[model samples]
Target chain A: MTPTLLGRIQTRWVLLWTIGLAWVLVVGPFLPLAGPSVGAVWLAGFRTLLIVSIVGTAWEFVYHGLQQLRWDKDWPTLFGLLVGLNEGAVAYVLLRNGLPLAIPGLTVAPFVWQFGTVWLVVWAVSNGPIRVLFPRWRFAGGRFW
Target chain B: MPRTLDPTDVPTVLGESDIARQGRRVLRRRFVTVGAGLGSLAMIHLWRLAGVADHALCAIGPLASPSDTYELLATNSQIPRHERLRSDSGSTIDAIWGWPGYALREAVEDSHPGSAIQALTEPVLHEFFTPKAGQVYRSVDREAARLGWSRVHQPGWVQMIRRAEGGGYWILAESLDDGPIAIAAEHVHVAIGYPGVQLLADLQQFRTDHPESGFRVANAYEAHGYIHDELLTRPSTVLVRGSGIVASRVLQRLLDDVEHNGAQTTVIHLFRTYVSDAQGDSPFFRRPAGNGFAYQPFNYPKSSWGGQLRARLETLDGEARAELIDGMGGTNTAPRRSWRRQLKRHEGRGTYRQMHGVVEKVVPTSDGVRTTIASADGTVATVDAAYVIDATGLQADPTTHPLYADLLARSGARRNPKGRLAVEPSFEVTGTRSGTGRLYASGAMTLGGHYAGVDSFLGLQYAALRIADDLAETGALPRIGPARSARGWLGWARNRRYDSNGVLA
Candidate 1:
């Protein structure tokens, strides 16, 4: 990649790393520990939680800044907030609880990977809409609803 | 505006009926072209904004003459009364003595929601109220005649005043009335609407500039099929763009034609957004909704209008409506109940298919045109089509219309990226930097301004009401207070009955 593109990626990674550290500090220890016999489930849950918290917290700040600074109240921010809040909450619970139930196995990787896959699918869907109705809406204003 | 001519004394020329003669006369009157300035884009904006405060007190002055006169006639049967209303203004509305589409009408009247906008409303309603074709222009000629106003076949501006003491408007002809009528009213509404055939120039240029790409597109609008017959049919593999109402109809027509001709033509439709086929899952006929196509409205009552959708949007705000329109992929192509059943039969046929792609460049080749398509997957494909019909959507340039050109030149109105008029919520074009007269716009031209994706019958009616509201503020057209009568209220109540009812119900 060109230096400029690599620089952007580097900046994003640094920011994510910083965020991941902060998340681990605040919610990591409080998270339930995995049962020794169910090591895989516990590791899967912890990793899932770590990724969600990191991505969600990062996106929330990004979208919040965009909405406030750019006046870009359109899709990116609105949708980001929606996905962030919902998926982030799920990841948070899984990380906190699933760690106690984990059983050791490499298959535990699916927990973290599932969300990334889903994110890619959602991102694809968000690129363009499918099946729209024309003259699709009407708006009322000026007190006389 | 009334002209006295006995029916018996009327002369027949070219075996034409009196109605046809009158239509011709109306057409002739509109041929009076004026070389008014397109004016400043700034001025246009100011005029639209100014119109709002001006129209706040404007009165629509009761539905002129025959409208009032007809109501009186309806009360008693003594004098022989015509079934329809004929005004001194020469316009008449066909009377379907009984409510023909009362079921849909009742639904609109009854459950008209309060303007409460939230996300998900557009989709929720789309599943309920579907839009139909040719409903917007159904009564244009009738409405024009009723007002004794001739339809302007060509676009232009006429000086409402000859250099008035303070200098008045150069009114763009929405429709022309008899004898150069002038309303002392300050606001001149330039509802040039969508700039007809001139709107397609960009797409025309796009297809023309790129001849080597082999994808075929079919535009909803065809003038003697010049583009379709000459270009579209020539391609072996065609990829049509857009998913609006017109696009839906064109696809149906293509399939119908292919069936009729027994041609194994491969058709790929590109929809920016995929709406659930209103046809659902019947094996024989399922079809996508109409998201981009709007044709002549002469065929409406036989087809349905988006009466329910209008009632639904009446509850949204400008930003919310924009979001809704954007979410709906900026087009209206609700599927017809019957047509859906037919389209479903071709699931595996090479004759028809749907794909999503965006065009970056269109280049012409020695044999045919080549199109470079970037599918949503980021895969690039270069294909040559015998013909390309850009049913993509309306691509208009304000500069193309003489009045808008004049207005844009002077900075009265500014053009959007799509080259349509940029207006405020009140239909005022935004760039009148001075913030002066508040010149409001209406019709298709204001697509992006306030109610984007709005070019349907109810959409037009909703816009008409907005214009009427502004006119009411101006006191030019006297105000008839909002519908509050028991009967009017009853009409409203009766209309909302189907708000929660599904189409199948």
Candidate 2:
């Protein structure tokens, strides 16, 4: 239950990053940008807050099972839903910033993008540092499936 | 809220902890049993803030199209006793055999104190009883007058609201009768019927939540009734679910329609359990006696004496009783003659089929509904039908009933796991201490609790008898003579009365 320094990053960092990125996509088009904007960037910021709250809550539950019931199966569902949401948010931010991206017609109003971000975060964190720093914490036998 | 501690603080008397006591109390009071434990859980969930908000939203929202007709209390109250029994025209259905005339007569003869009361009811009741279950309408005026029960003869929407304890209710009442003058008793017997019409409200909400998938998901009772009414107009294909009396009746209605109207309506039946035939031949293909087919009704010998044997077996332990029930069978097999005739007629006709499975989802096809039915083997088969009749079955979840919220709030009532009102063997709500106004319940609401089988007519009658006995124990039924001791005899007589005109009154 105790949180380590890096654990905090593992938990909170991606959530904030996903939200910050999603804000640029959802609000960029509507914001008062010099060339193309007519509305407020605040709209996107507000949406990012909502999307992040949903995505973060979902990821937290997956990374640490509800009340930390490790073997409980709800983690899979939580991971999947969050990862999908996170992916959409990433694509949206890339498109809004005019960065070269493979995703076509990127838009991120939906909360699905956060799902992907959380799913990846859980997979990486569970298998990465936690396994290396605390090998004992890793599930025994076959690679923490 | 913390559960009140046991009155007797003696450690020996306090057999259970506060939480366990609370759970048991809720179970006993709400009549929760193993079969219906989930319903009580759903009811508890409904009590949460989120649950209440969801229900409130449902109440104020525009109702979706009802899976079946919504029978309101006002319209039902207005239906005269005579007209309610038969179709609007009041003609007896001679087409179907075994009209229950003998049962109706037996019920009357058993009920009557003698000639006088018999004369008043026998003829009129006989006239009204018919094939359809709901049509047996009694004035309630007479029963109400005799029992001192208050009758709301013709209630409207406003009146129903008032009856629902103020306004803002969406429940459609078919009838509302208060038992003759209050016996100042603790228990109340509520018997509207299984899968009552009020369920339409819940169905409306379900359809609203899943609008894209909403198709013809009607209950067996309503669907069968509809088939009998508009046989020729039925869409080409139909899907019926659940393997119960209702399923059998629905098949009979469809087959009868094809026979009478020469229409081509394909019927597919669904069952949750796989029925293994001894000979691998459809039960319908075998003929039994003169004219009638020897269909092996489920629960076999027990179904023959379904009333007595079930009670006797339930007295045993779970494993023993399950063994007994297993020996009996879970689904009913139609009479050989009826199934044979229909089977032979529709064998190559491309009109009828029976399958055991469930629909995972229903998608609207351009021409009809494209349903994905998952069999027991995990095989998913797609069937396209112009209309989809759910006939799935009913849920006892208190959430399904409109009045549950009010009842729970006003009284510290908790639903049993079955989602119906839980009561003890004495039919008293658990957790309710003595002097809590004996609020007993009857009908399927108490199924899996003290009194099982509150769904069947025989079951209802048994429950009524039990309630009567309980009330008598408490000296509630002051007018009636000594309580009847022989439950089976009473049940037999009641069945006879329903049979007088081949229609149960």
Candidate 3:
């Protein structure tokens, strides 16, 4: 997708991802205070946890964001979430192959593959977490009990 | 604000003998008539909302007098005198403009200031301030009196509606007060609520098999006070078929009898597929309970009537609309906390028992109706109960109405994908648009039409308001400006009559 298309609106997942990355960067310097080798493994585990949380949270945003519209709260979206989970699996594989940042400068991929991997993460998060968390805001519609 | 009546349209004052039918009347000549209870109320509300003081509209239906229709539903449903309606306070049947709406009016009338304040501040409070069924009845009664309904309402059974010689349509009706009369009207709005709810097959079979037993079976629609009367005297078990609002209401009545009259009555709740958690997982729907009873807040979202959702529904095709309708369809009711608590108490006391099964057959027994049911776990058994209250809803098939069938045959009227009448966005029945005039249908009959909440109180209000605007656009009624609207609101507020047909008493 063109930057202009993505820039047109501040889609919820994109902002969530911005916050997530900012969090990781802020905490990255504190990893060594815990220990050396243990800290490295902990950082790897922390990154995986972030990926998982992002996957779970970002899918809703992607499903609604692709249509460039707000998600309808009443929509029975079990099928859509399943599809987002599938995309998250693919992102996890790409990250395993060292596409995304591994302690800042450790990506062993071509510029294009890295861009593709980042796009997939964005897509995954949008569909999963963002879509799940903030899909709708109508007060009168939806469940009463 | 009552209009000046023409000399030809003189009042028929019923003497002591005919006074029982107070709202019944005889009219020699009138330009048009739109019949039925809710439909007539809709027309009145529409005129008031638009601030149109008069029109050519008249109504001839079973609603003989003020509060007649309201009393029928409220009393039939066995709603206690002071009990609030199951729907939200926003759902109103009294006024069109709804300046204060139901909650505000009820709060004032019931003297519940906290409820009124809660309704104003916390919009999500479900049980904060709903109006009582009796209050609504009285409110409509007062409104009907003010609107000169006694003069305009002609008590009659509409046999059929056919095209007139040159223009408009002829309403063939046999008046209750006077004899057979015909009114040629430019527009006819049909709002017959429903044909009776069809009794279950097993009940029919049981009746046929054992004609001697004489145990009675009743549906929720009928005036089955005998069920309450019978239980009030002796101990009895009721096999209540169908799990909806009607079932709940029936149970409530039985419980009330048990509490006050020293009667012993048990409710047998039969279910087809008993989901363990009938309260569904979706945050968007107040789903039915595990006991096979609906517990939704209101019939539909507020947006279903006059908001963006309505506009969105209008944009979709018949198929898409039907799918959306299906998603929203099915039996549902408000989850009143008191009702839940009472039911829980009954369950603990062994007065209520739930079963998951479909009836294989029902045979007559010496004790009661012996019903053979097949359970979900492949178990089958036969049980007997004193009464069977079929709480299943009515059959709203458009073809069932003789007039609708005639309209379909004479005109090109058709059903939407949802098996209800297809209507234009203006609420005019799609195929019944004739020369310079139109035929409109409202309430449950217009279920598949542009509006989603067609059968709801607000839905009726919406249909009437839109139909009025559409009629005004076609030059059937006068244009309503700000001044006229304000006048109509004032008249309603002040308990003054502002007749839509421009006629006065």
Find the candidate with the highest lDDT and give its number. Answer: 3
The CAPRI quality class of candidate 3 comes to incorrect
> Across residues B184-279, which tens digit of lDDT does each residue of candidate 1 receive?
223444543334432234346655655333233334453324433442354355556666544555566566556665545566666555554432
lDDT value, residue B446 of candidate 2 = 61
Query: Candidate 3 regions off by >4 Å?
Result: A1-145, B1-33, B48-55, B121-128, B208-215, B278-291, B499-505
Estimate every model's Cα lDDT from 0 to 1.
0.37, 0.36, 0.59
How does candidate 1 score on lDDT?
A: 0.37
TM-score, cand. 3 vs. native = 0.70
Rank all candidate structures by their TM-score, best first, as comma-separated numbers.
3, 1, 2
Model 1 DockQ vs. reference: 0.01
Question: Taking the tens digit of each residue's C-alpha lDDT, what string does model 2 give over B292-388?
Answer: 1223422132111122233344465435544444343334443334555675667567676666566576666665666677877778998777555
Q: Can you tell me which runs of candidate 1 are displaced by over 4 Å?
A: A1-145, B1-140, B150-167, B172-185, B196-218, B224-236, B271-325, B335-344, B360-367, B397-400, B409-411, B414-438, B449-454, B482-505
Winning candidate number (TM-score): 3
lDDT of 3 by residue, B1-505 (tens): 1122232222221122222232423343323444558657767656544443443546778666545655676677676557766554545666665445676776677787765655544333334356677777777778777776676677877766655444566666677767666666667777766644566766666667676754567667767887789887778888877766677777788887787788899878787656455543445443445445554555654445543356567887788988666555566655667777778899899998888799998766666777789988799977688887778767778787666676666666888888878888777888776666578888888887677788777677667767777878987667555455656656666777655544332
User: Looking at model 3 chain B, which ten-residue stretch has the lowest summed lDDT?
Assistant: B1-10
Error of 2 at B69 (Å): 12
